[model samples]
Target: MLVKHFPGETIGIIGSSMASALLAQEAGRLGYRVASLVLQEQNPVRQFCNWQTICPVYDETALRHFAGRVDVVVAETGLLSHQDYKILAAITDLTLSDDLMAITTDRLIEKVFLDSQRCLVTPFSMVTSLKDIKEAVEYIGFPCVLKTTQRHLPQSSDHVILYSEEDYERAERKVEESTCILEAWIPTEKKASLTLVRNERGEMLLYPVFEVIGSGELHLKQVRYPANISSMVEAEMRRVAQVIGQALDLIGSLTLEFFITSAGVVYINEASVGLSSEAIFTLGSMSMSHFEATCRALVGLPLPDLLPRGRAAIALPLVDLNYDEVMTQYMMRTDWHFAFFNPRGHSVEDMQGYVIVIGDSIKHCERQIELSRLTHHPK
Candidate 1:
């Protein structure tokens, strides 16, 4: 069902994530009332919400009561189960699609959907045991990642890359512990991500692709707007993004991460239905941030198309370990835009703060990056 929202109408936000809080804030700013449900200990939404219900996310009674208090519902993915999706869909205007959730929440299922849509996907095959993994590796090739289908497992136990048979020992426990899928790891010089938003009428919006600069091991570094890729690669990424969005019947926004090789081969990594901390750059870089754009898309309002407003923008995430260094630079770099999270739901490692540097061109941002010593820990 197509649901259109107007000012003063209650928009029910159904998660405690920062993404949900950001959405609530935007909905409120747009003249809409924001109602929220959150867990007590972690309540980023409480400060922004007009009306709030505090409870466990899966509590049926609480969920129903919360649903009834608003006109439309939006949830940050990972907060709801397949059954919960059915429950909420039946009772209220749940904006996130159950099919999309069902597919995206499971890596194997998501890869299958992407394949069926004729979108590029990393080569993969499910492996159950040492024998299965060894045989699969022959075709999937070396330097492949072994990942558990279930994401809720411990992070360490979930993934291991197999470069050879000796490496299988590292992944043996994961393969034995859960249903696992092995995927060919595309060696790449650049990692890029695209955010896509779709309205109820099936209209969609694509934000500019972001190029993520990280370490050789893929550790965090910084993110630059409008990926420095050839026009052909960018065009193909956009083409697949539209196909995936339309196929998912998306009623909200999601991000797709892609691996771009030095040779310019583009391989889809994975899709995330939940809010991405990586995309926080949109806040300082674009004319319309992802939060506001997602709200507008959900309510059947005009989307601003998320155009880049500046010549270039880069986002640097801060952590607890960098306190002294960040502060020293903070004093010197008054021009930098620094945003600190509310210390509500976020752990220090997830993100203590972030700095966004926007300039007239990529050259200017590059200069700022050197001044900030973004490549090294604040010393």
Candidate 2:
């Protein structure tokens, strides 16, 4: 089970998103040479890595050439097809197994894996046609969520919530043209995620659970560290995460998102084997961040002991704002941390960034968010 160490070695990243940039930054901090393979010529992540190459992921010859130059490869964007994974696995050491990557990227496969483990998951059924949608509705009940089974589909929203027949009728055409999954939408008392890292030695480390707040589109809007759930609930979540990680034989960082019902029932919502967006808050709140932990795990390094400083909140703004202006306004606030991604000539609306505020109490964190609202809007 001894994996290769990556100190002073090259780490290859596959993707050009903000998450990929963060990974490159973390790897650089750990003394690893970073190289990124991107599809576009103007990727913002180019600034964060030591080397960058423009190549399509589907081109196996280009992928092999890129993989040959790195000690290990990590896919930041979960848009890789099954064949792409196979090509990468054949060329280099992947942080995740092909099976794990295949399962975690597809919603239908993920649900089936969770069910096979006897994990508590939301009621779900696959829908490929209008007749299938009706059957799924009958099984999962009304007020459910319809989401694409595959990631990065062409010209489609990731998910939609249907409250009535009208909503379903309006979405029927789109649903019929693509594969989808229908899941009963539980009224959650709290939405939280547990991030864990499994190293090559089979050792696992679990970080503090983060209470998540999302926008109407289900994008994570805010994250609070050290979730306010009971100890028993936290322990249960840890157990479930460990089980899922072990079952997958996962060797990198994984995040399992959960929904806590009013009755205290915990249900698995989804899983991500890549870096989570909440890493910004973790870097501000915990002694070790998810990005750093992921790098450590991939290189056969031991996980660090998590030491939480205080309550931390991360605000994700929906509207585009002047980066310098936002930084200048928050520079005087020593307790606040701001990170703005380089837009690389892209529109601000397409940019992703976060502001982290650490406070002594939850109310103090809330006050910082309220104060920030004077300048930034959700839009």
Candidate-wise lDDT, in order: 0.76, 0.77
lDDT of 1 by residue, 24-54 (tens): 8889899999998777755667768887877
Q: Per-residue lDDT tens digits of candidate 2, residues 1-379?
A: 3458667899998887666777888899999999989888887678788888986554778788988998888886456766777788777788777678778568889898999999999999988877887778887878998888777466434577888887867558768767888889998998889989888778887887887665653234667776888888899999999999898988888888999988889999988777776656776666777788888888888886777766555545534344454666566776666666655677754656676768877788877656655345344
TM values, all candidates: 0.83, 0.86
RMSD (CA, Å), candidate 1 to true, equals 4.1
Worst 10 residues of 2 by lDDT: 314-323
What TM-score would you give candidate 2 relative to the actual structure?
Answer: 0.86
Note the clash tally of each candidate: 0, 0
Top-TM-score structure, candidate number = 2
The pairs that clash in candidate 1 are: none
